[model samples]
Target: MIWKTIKVNFHRLGSPPTFYRLAEVLAPWLWGGFAVCAAIGLYQALYVVPPDYQQSDSFRILYIHVPSAWQAMAGYVVMTILAVIALVWRIRTVEIMAMAGAPIGAAFTFICLATGSLWGRPMWGTWWAWDARLTSMLVLLFIYLGIMGLYAAFEDRRKGARVACILILVGIVNIPIIHFSVEWWTTLHQGATIRLFSGESTLHESMMPPLVWMTIAVKLMFGAALLDRARNDLLDQDRRKGWVQSRLGETA
Candidate 1:
């Protein structure tokens, strides 16, 4: 039954008409959620939240920095999963998702590092540090770039996807190392942000609400971005197919 279900889905997999219909249903909802959540998050962070005692306004960067870091890693994790699926199933759409995810993850990593540096200058008295966590994150950004480059290198796109997928799986070992380095080694990086195991936050309560809201907004934005990018990838890959042409005609 499972194998039959897989076969059925695989047969319909390249049907751009079906995928485009699904994309149409998702697009509006994704964009709408993004707009509403973004506005509220920004308001909550900027106006409603109080300043941090230690870093004052500088801590406000955490609203952006932390979430960007979280999503950057999250994006890569999704990308890696998609890559594995593509390799195992030889699914073109899955490969496309991995392709789309790399740049988005790279963008998130860039934001995290930039905002982190900005925050560091005010708080740590240094704009740049060679700390384990920071270094590992930097490596993660490079991994994203590497995967994208690998995806583009081979003349055969499928071959490229497979190779890139392997690389992602290998590079993922660094993510756990990055997360635990601060705990294992005495590092400049701070501890957990939303630690449930701990009774209380190291941060002030006034700043927590906006930070939480902003994280939610970031997550929503990432989801919307992923959906749009995946749709674009599907369209490109399916252009020569009958369903895609039919859908194009229907839209026209």
Candidate 2:
């Protein structure tokens, strides 16, 4: 019964109007959640949590850096799922969503790289290093740019999305590499301080709260951004359709 309900909703979401309406309704809520969570997280990270003995206030950067890095990878994973559904089911809405996610993911990747560099300058004595983790993250950024470029290259957006979906699938390998790079290679980047599966965390309990709050904030932010972009893409793609015309007429 649950599966049937989910199946019904999934099909309904494939309808452009339905998806657009859903995005419109949900995006504002997501953005609100992001704003609230980010405000709390920033407060806790800056004032509530004590500085690290070794790194001092500089380590606070991790509150932003870690979440951005996680969301960058998480956004790609969302795109991958959407891409697979798009390829297999030929769902137009899914294709639009998959394409729309690239820029948001790229933004997070840029933040990750930028913050990492800022954190590294004081710790590693260099602004940049070709370390395994850093190098793989840089590659991830390039992959995101490549996906965006490929999608924009074709005049037919659907055809471009199909080709880019293949690239999205191919890019999945980099996610695992990024996750394990610290373990696999000697990099300046630290290994996981908080382990989910093992239920072991090297980080102090007090420092964990900000990371938790910031991670949720970014996830909410990503969803909000994705839905906003996807809705715009849908409107642009379906501008000639009667439903879109009616929506525009109503809005106007």
Candidate 3:
């Protein structure tokens, strides 16, 4: 029964028309959520939340840096998972999802690195350092770049998707290592104490809620961007199909 349901759902997913319509409906909600959440999160972080006793005013970087880093890590994992599904089941929709994730993930990764540098200058007495955590994140950024390059450079998308899919699988090994590197190895980057309701979280009440809200805002932004890109992608791939012609005709 479960397998039958999976099979049927996948059949619908194989249809570009269905996936395009689904993405169309979702794009608005995703962008709307991002805008609303971001407004609240920023107000809380920038105005309501007090500065850290230790770091003072510079701690404001956390509102941007922490959330971007978290999303960078999250977007990669999501891409890797979609890549794996694309490879295993040959799902066209999954491939599109992986493609949708590349640029957005790369954007977040760059934000993490840039904001980390800004924060590091004041806190760590340097603009940059190649510590284990820093090094791993840099590598992740390059991985995202490679995935985008792989797809764009090819004449045949199927072959390109295969190459990028392989890279995504290879890079996933870095995620766990990146998370634990601060703990397992001697590194300048600090270890995570708070991770989405983890036991180690000790952040104060005022700070915690805003941090979470910021994270949601980033996730929503990613979703909206992904849906927009995915819709364009599906359209490009299915341009010759009848539904697309009908869709265009209806709009006309």
Candidate 4:
């Protein structure tokens, strides 16, 4: 019964109008959640948590860096799932959503790289290093840019999205590489401080709260931004359709 209901809703979401309306309704709530969570996370990270003995206040940067890195990878995984659905089902809404995720993922990757660099300069005595983790993350950013460029290169958006979906599938390898780079290679980047599967964490309990809050905030931000972008893409793609025309007429 549950599976049948899910299948029904999934088909309903493939309808452009249904998807657009859902995006419109959910995005604002997601954005609100992001704002509240981020405010609380920032407060806790900056004032509530004590500084590391070795890194001092500089460790606070991890609160932002870790979440951005996490969301960057998580966003790509979401795009990959959407891409697979698009390729197999030829669902136009899924294709647009897959494409919409690239820029947002790229933005998060940029933040991760930028903040990592800022954190590194003091710790590693260099602004940049070709460390395994850092190098793989840089590659991830390039892949994101390449996907966006490929999609734009074609005049037909659907065709472009199809080609880009293939690229998204191909790039899935990098995510695992990024995750395991620290374990596989000697690098300045630290290994996992918080382990999910093992239930073993090296990080102090007090520091965990801000990280948890910030992680949730970024996830919310990603969802909100993705839906907004997908909705805009849908509107632009369907501008000539009667539903879109009616929506514009109503808005006007």
- Each candidate's clash count: 0, 0, 0, 0
Q: Clash number for model 3?
A: 0
Ordered list by lDDT, greatest first: 4, 2, 3, 1
Q: What is the lDDT of candidate 3?
A: 0.88
Candidate 1 segments whose C-alpha is farther than 4 A from its true place = 1-15, 197-199
lDDT of each: 0.82, 0.96, 0.88, 0.97
Which of 1 and 3 is the better model by TM-score? 3
Q: Which has the better TM-score: candidate 1, or candidate 4? A: 4
Q: Write the per-residue lDDT of candidate 1 for residues 1-252, one digit (tens) a residue.
A: 999998887667545566557666887787788788778878888888877666667677788899899999888888878878888888776777778888889999999999999888868889889988899999999999999899888888778878998999999998898778788777788877677585777766767777677777787778778778878877776689887788789879
Predictions: Cα RMSD each? 2.6, 1.1, 2.0, 1.1
TM-score of each: 0.89, 0.97, 0.93, 0.97
TM-score of 2: 0.97
Please, what are the lDDT tens digits per residue for candidate 4 over residues 1-252?
999999999899999999999999999999999999999999999999999999999999999999999999999999999999999999999999999999999999999999999989999999999999999999999999999999999999999999999999999999999999999999888898889998689999999999999999999999999999999999998999999999999999
- Please identify model 2 stretches exceeding 4 Å from their true place: 1-3
Tell me which of candidates 2 and 4 scores higher on lDDT.
4
